[model samples]
Target: MDVNTRHVLIAGGGYVGMYAAFRLQKSLRKEIRRGEVTITVVEPRSYMTYQPFLPEAAAGNLEPRHVVVPLRRVLPDVQVITGRVVGIDHAEHTARIDPRDGAAYDVHYDELVVALGSVARTLPIPGLAERAIGFKQVEEAIQLRNHVLDRLDVAESTTNEETRRRALSFVFVGGGYAGVEALAELEDMARYACRYYRNFRAEDMRWVLVEAAGRILPEVGEDMGRYTVERLRKRHIDVKLNTMLESCVDGHVELSDGTRLDSDTIVWTAGVKANPVLAESDLPRDDKGRLPTEPDLRVVGAEHVWAAGDCAAVPDLTGPPNAVCSPSAQHAVRQAKVLGDNVARALKGRLLQNYEHKHVGSVASLGLHKGVAQVYGIKLRGWPAWFMHRTYHVSRMPTLNRKVRIVADWTLGLFFPREIVSLGSLQRPREEFERSALPRQFSPPASRSPELESAHAGGRPEQDGK
Candidate 1:
């Protein structure tokens, strides 16, 4: 392999991909400058979302844009392609790229990093796909915020009790950090928004968290989980444990515990599975559909291919003998550093290092000035945990510019009330315009031209024949 002019193609622009490219660009600065190495990153979005702040974004505590790092702006030295990798031919070291509505093309690479992060793992729940929304991206977060506020608007405008109740009811599935934080933050926002509505009170809103498991926040331990449940219960939010959503047909929720709820909004945050693009590739994946990787983050049995983050089943040397790394922002960020260095080492013909980081504790923000955290075996709750959650995540969010912007948002939020204006029209932006431009029968009658009026009357206007 030629040391000069070697191309490194990275799939997915999530935390792992972005960090890996960021590190590689810095580590291989000389090679990049000398035209010895080229780093290319392909992803559907132009920005990398810092998912830790997604809950806050939904709660109006953080700007949606500030929670995402623009890939091109952050990695100017790297080639950032706004496209999706449809297939990966490992044997040929080529990737099939679809530039989103454009013709597909293939790109060759000497080294390939498969960081295609996981997508929301969904089950065949009735009415799930159509009625429920997933809390995964910035768009979803923004949409959910608007949706919650829109529901409040509906409830306030409706006179029917059932309609009002349904509009104010929200059901959230999954008990993990994503589910818990999202529920707590949104509940807080809804409660605050109630102050603006004369008919809607904080108690009028029904926030239900249903987890199939016995407890929530399993990462923070059973103690914290129990405390979180209690705290939520105190806030009048229903915490249903060991509960399965039997069906959510048309937003009418049926639970395994024989309880039925009429909710307009259902947020699904259950879990995630590896990106299915791995199946399309010739890469070796494990039973769970994640790429089986060595401790150095290299794909097992593939010399030039590497994998990391949620899509890779990396052996956990720091834990039990057969344990694999869990999918989390903490692990992904740490793994990217090691993976990036190893890729640089491979290109320069140097010895590679192993990735053996132990699982640090977790922090979860419950709401404004409220949270629970377990860091370095120490447990904290309430204001301390909330402060820690914000501090840790902001420090980790990519780019100093983003960090400052987020902090500024928080600082401003201290003095200002939460913005509850519902921009739900954004979801179907052209609806109003389309409705207005509908057929004449559907639209209101308007003054017509004299010729058009004459034609409509089924007669010609009087004309002189000379």
Candidate 2:
């Protein structure tokens, strides 16, 4: 079977896959026009979400729609199928795709790109599965915002102090970028929301961060991490270092430090592991289950298969001596650009470029008006760091249109207040009204007017002896 005769199938549609497909579409425009090569992308979602701004999206800084790039619109030349790639039969040069609606498929791919990304790493701790929310997707961010506000609403109206305390207490497990940023943003938002609540006060709410390690933000160095801890503590946030979550059952959280707390919300952003799909493939994976890749971003042994991003253990040539690339948006995005370009080059029989990027210092959001940053070994704290955090991420947010939208959101946020309105009705669609009306219809006949019945039933009424 001639390899170039078949299509190139990319899996995941995340940072690497989407960008790779875009570069391929651009590089192979003439080939695609002449029907020489075809590109097919298999992903569970139709859109590729930029994850860095998810914290702000959760805090209502950026609109939800502006954070993601539609795969179909970005790569129209490529066949975008909403499906899960089950496995890679590298020996047969085929992939098994499981479509949500219909039968599974065996797609023959002359070239394959494994960019399935990563999943939130979790432990076998009791009740964590039920009690914790992850910080991965846009939906999770939005859901978190809604859940927090709902908890505030409960606390404001409840008379029981215990229940109110539990409603207002939020425990976050993990001290990484996600946990820190989310806690900071939510704390800011909650503090702002307190002005609107008659009974609920910002001091009444508790924000706690639990980390197993001695320090947080490993990327930001030990000194900066300590600075962050101090800043958070100044705001009265309980930053419990060297602590672990033993269990969280029935809203009661047990910590390794022999402390217990009953909280309604628990967010888990401790770590991430390579997608479970990697186990189904024949590619060479490291002990941690990430696909082993060369510096050039090609799979270790396979000729046609390439990988990058969090799912692949990329060699960090620019690391302190030697280390693997940290699973971060910076590495992922830069690696994706390289991976895309390499794929385009490989297709055109050109030399591929090696992936070697120096580590830029880290920036973290402390809250609304505070932050910490370390760039080129110069540490910055307070509003300067906070502004830098937002500025850098917004600049990297993909596409000029989205950049403009995000800037507009930030500009409006300065003058206008945060939109804390909870449209919980949005979650139920039209079913809430239908539910209330349906129960009323089951009441006495006189209670149900003819107009109401006609309106709800589309101009029809229940059959009866008139």
Best by TM-score: 1
Q: What is residue 443's positional error in candidate 2, in angstroms?
A: 7.7
Model 1 lDDT per residue over 336-422, tens place: 999999999999999999999888899999999999999999999999999999999998998889999999999999898888899
Given candidate 1, what's the lDDT at residue 319?
Answer: 94
What are the runs in model 1 whose C-alpha is more than 4 Å off? 1-4, 439-466
Task: Report every candidate's CA lDDT.
Answer: 0.94, 0.88
The per-prediction CA RMSD against the true structure, in angstroms, equals 5.5, 5.3
Q: How many residue pairs clash in each candidate?
A: 0, 0
- What TM-score does candidate 1 reach? 0.93
